[model samples]
Target: MLKFLKQVTDYTKGAVDAARFIGQGLSVTFDHMQRRPVTVQYPYEKLIPSERYRGRIHFEFDKCISCEVCVRVCPINLPVVDWEFNKEAKKKKLKHYSIDFGVCIFCGNCVEYCPTNCLSMTEEYELAAYDRHELNYDNVALGRLPYKVTQDPMVTPLRELAYLPKGVMNPHDLPEGARRAGKLPEEILDEMKETQDGESEAASANAK
Candidate 1:
């Protein structure tokens, strides 16, 4: 019958469409199988942290006014700002500043709200210690500059996700002298300045 033939045709078409979709799903898995492993070995190899990454806090002892601003801004008031009022100079003299890293949450509020540009966030996340008390960083320890992963000779620094080259997901198999996908922060700023200059020139020409 004509009705039976039409039904068979419709069923065959549906089956083909389903098969196509299943093939499409399998294609991605096959593509991924061809790619190399993305595993990064710890201690010997480390991934470079992103530019805006919030990690360990670096403090400047001389720049800190003992204002207790860091303590107030902190959610837990973790910064211990020990100071004495210098009667002769009539200023709060900073004695010893300390931050217990074990108790302190790495919220970066202290770094953000510091009056003086004394506090800054460093990319040093490796703060593992045998004892909890060892984690408490005094002004001296806080002021010390953190070792950069990209600069280390012993460790191999690998880029991930956004830092990787365009369409290249595997960082381990990077070609020498290959650039990142996006423009640098400096490039973006330069573009903004150029745009502003062009706009100003256009406005001046129209006014004249």
Candidate 2:
């Protein structure tokens, strides 16, 4: 009789504990039901992205010196740069600049390594496409800044030099000169001389 009474007391305690837990859970559910829904309507309502949000990549062509630092730093080697030295003009010009966005991880390494600050990320993250081939972007496509991105204060400063003029002559694209001269071009030599002269004058001024 004593053992049966002890078992009945333990069973009664277990039932009470189970009921308390169920009541607590129901109370939480009821409290949550009283709150407003946080769901947003897609395609019509859009949320503004934060400043640091990394999205599509933008390229500033005029600012790009073709240093290839972006290409070197890219984790997936998505940026393809084809450039050659123009012996006559004494400048490097890009033959081709393309990015395979399909393979791009958007790791921001390219933007980070760009010495001229020519690369940046935009807030346009809707990158879905029907065909994979359409995802590949060349220099011209990458150079075009998004409409929303143009309004950004941070990017507005670089608007002028961001896109190069269409007819601008690329030094590398010029026809090869008749003479294959091993020495640097006269224009380059003159510029170097002028720079040196300026530096020397500054040094003398400082000394005085």
Question: Candidate 1 residues 123-194, lDDT tens each?
Answer: 998999999999999999999998799999999998867788788888785777888889988999999999
> Which residue pairs overlap in candidate 1's backbone?
none
Please provide TM-scores, in order, for all candidate models, with all chains considered together: 0.80, 0.55
Q: How many Å off is the CA of 16 in candidate 1?
A: 24
For candidate 2, report its TM-score: 0.55
| Model 1 spans > 4 angstroms off | 1-36
What C-alpha lDDT do the candidate models reach, one value each? Answer: 0.91, 0.72
Estimate the Cα RMSD of every predicted model relative to the unseen true structure: 7.1, 18.9
Encode model 2's per-residue lDDT on 1-208: one tens digit a residue.
Answer: 9999999999999999999999999999999887644443444334445456788788877787888888788887779888899999899987778887899998899998788998899877778899998889888988887546435454321111112133332212223332222334687899899999999999999999
lDDT of 2 at 57: 87
